[model samples]
Target: MAAVPMDDPGRTPSSYWAATAAAGPDIPPFDGSERADIAVIGAGYTGLSAALYLAERGFSVLVLDANEPGWGASGRNNGQVVAALKHEPHEIEERFGKERGGELIRTIGEGPDLVFGLIERYGMPCDARRSGILTAAHSAASLADLQRRVDVWARRGAPLRLMSRSELESQSGTAFYPGGCIDPRGGAINPLGYARGLAAAVLQQGGHIRRQAHVRSIRRAASGWQVMLDSGSVMASRVIVGTNGYTDDLWPGLKRTFLPARTPQIVSRPLRDNLRKSILPVGQIMSDTRYLTVGVRMHADGRLHLGGGGGTAGADRPALYEQLPREARRLFPQLGDIEWEFRWSGFMAMTPDRYPRLFELAPDIAASLGYSGRGICTATIMGRELARWAAGEAAIDELVLPASSFRTLPYYALRGPIVEGTVLFHSLRGRLKTPG
Candidate 1:
């Protein structure tokens, strides 16, 4: 078994998702030889969903994970399945073009559909629900910008609802938000269950899954490629590196192309029945308009998840937690009285382009990594797109989204300093305007 990295406070190690996991199976370690048509190196949504789809296509597949499936970011995410990318529509059109951009929007706008569809198909009980997502605006400028987005989403038949300050206060249980827009199409789910269930579905479809199996290196074999592991090795016709932000120096230069920013989340003790019934009366997931976005939602267990914040391990958690209280209390004053029972965080990879990166590393070897922070749905979307590309269903250019080569940040080594400095600047600027 590959050495499991010790959980850090910034890694969301004590997840409510982990607390409720339904006896994750004790799959055997990869102690011996294995060969398959395809080998997937991570068992999160991207890797597991890829395994399921490939197995459905009658390919012999093997999935290897260093830890338990869904134990990484997949299990511990905020679980908000949003419809659009963080970008606005005209911006998307301006960036990728009207046709390709429109298709990407339409494809992922149904992101929640792909999520709930799999849940229903497999009869997986993962607290899947179509509760829409509300992007709350704390300022008038943010609300105006939100209004423009609501307009574009409406034009595309996304079924959004505009909330006034009164409606926002009523729903948010706090007056801090001036207003925001409601996305009727997006929703929430138990993300850990989604990833584990995907693994289960892949196994049911006759695929092999190996936990505690970590690929240490990848090299070209004669007809295919060979992956070296801590104990044994696997040879396969194709290999996919879905490690994302968890990616390391296993392959040089890949990690530099992506910024591994750490974001954390905390969950309050389960609310009483009355508070549960009142706070999320409409059953919508929510996030705020800050540059450092705060995502909040109620779980089926009746607890509220307050998610956002940045920095690396050890030194970062307390610093980030200090920034959370005001915004959290503002969104739900009821929360001001409740102490968080659990807190954790994880790192997500972001490319300079702000889009998921897909590239062919070599002939017959490819990688689809760096989904920014939208790995749950976006990663699954890319997995399916990748399956098609692998089976020759479409060429790389024929991909639903524009394909591009990778790039690096000139100040890659200084990202940590940049994060700390930016946060300091924003806080100072806020103080200057308020004279406090």
Candidate 2:
């Protein structure tokens, strides 16, 4: 087999989250042959959480990563802890049937709580907040959608409330939105810091996490599964693959299951206290109903962070960098002449159905990926579920989300134009929406 090239450990991503978050301790890469009861690939939130939980149960666990923990999407997202899936509730119920749909709803509804609970339990200093998440309506059509969302989630026992335009103006400090709703279960956090904290917790529990140890291949061995690295290998009873958007050819036909999307974010120099107060006054994380999905959050250091506009990785088109700042000034004119400080992008795996996928590839091998853009909370949920499944504490079918047989996307090579055209259409639709 050809050796798999790993991400550069010496390269640092340009991100406001990474620039300010505390650094984690040094972790060495795999050197020689090793044995473990369980091995996890991709040391992001899912792998680290699985390692921590499995180690707490006295199982020998090892985690391997192409880069350090959070160096991928886990470290580069907008940091919103959204609890709901990308699809509407009615759509989910119609697709999965009432009983199973309710199960899925309850599971996703508890995602944010699980994230915050872990932080508190481990005393992780990740700038986590449970203030809430507000989905604002930019037009009358969007407001109608929010109405349906509030009613649907309320029926499922969610603490959701529909706010008036006046309430939105007061809370969000802008009149651009007609109205919206707040999900008390949703919030925000420092995603990079959270990933590092999880790694620390895993180490404290005696789990081994090896940075720069990229898996080149996985095949059955006398021990159950053999994971091949560049300079060494590991024998394990079970393996969990959580590579997400960075998934490669480690497992045959695995990376074709989803489309990798590049979402860019822009940060401003610290806004004046008055300007910060007038925008996102209550400190709630906020996003609009545009198809392109505009979102903004206030950083702990008083800088404003905003994300939108999907494009290719490392493109850094001048047009793309101007998109967020232009929208920000339009919404909050107080943000005049914004001095942009940071511009970076993260890759999220977008499934055709926009739902996360879990697979039991073989009896001893399992994988989870494609959380859409809700990884801050859903990744944690998947990690814990993976650990439980590996430990025989829960069966795959009994898990919150259904496990699906591996399905590859048709015409996967044409994803570039397809994704770009789809995003362009969404942008046009967003521009057409004006409050009635």
Q: What C-alpha lDDT values do all the predictions have?
A: 0.74, 0.84
lDDT (Cα) of model 2: 0.84
Q: Write the per-residue lDDT of candidate 1 for residues 42-114, one digit (tens) a residue.
A: 8888788778888899998899887768867788778888877767888888988999999998988887788
Which candidate number would show the highest lDDT if scored against the true structure?
A: 2
Candidate 2 lDDT by residue in tens digits, 1-436: 1111133233448788888888875788788889999999998888888888999999999999877888888888888998888878888888788888878888888989888988898888789989999998889877999999999988877889999999988998888888999988889888998998999889888999998787988999976999999889999999999999888889998888987777889999998888888888898999988767878888768899899755543344576566788788878887778688998876788888888999998888989999878787778888998999999898887777789879999856776766677787877777888563
What are the clashing pairs of model 2?
none
- List runs of model 2 lying over 4 Å from the truth: 1-10, 313-318, 434-436
TM-score of each: 0.92, 0.95
Runs in model 1 deviating more than 4 A are 1-12, 313-316, 425-436
Q: What C-alpha lDDT, on a 0 to 100 scale, does residue 287 get in candidate 1? A: 82
lDDT of 2 at 410: 86
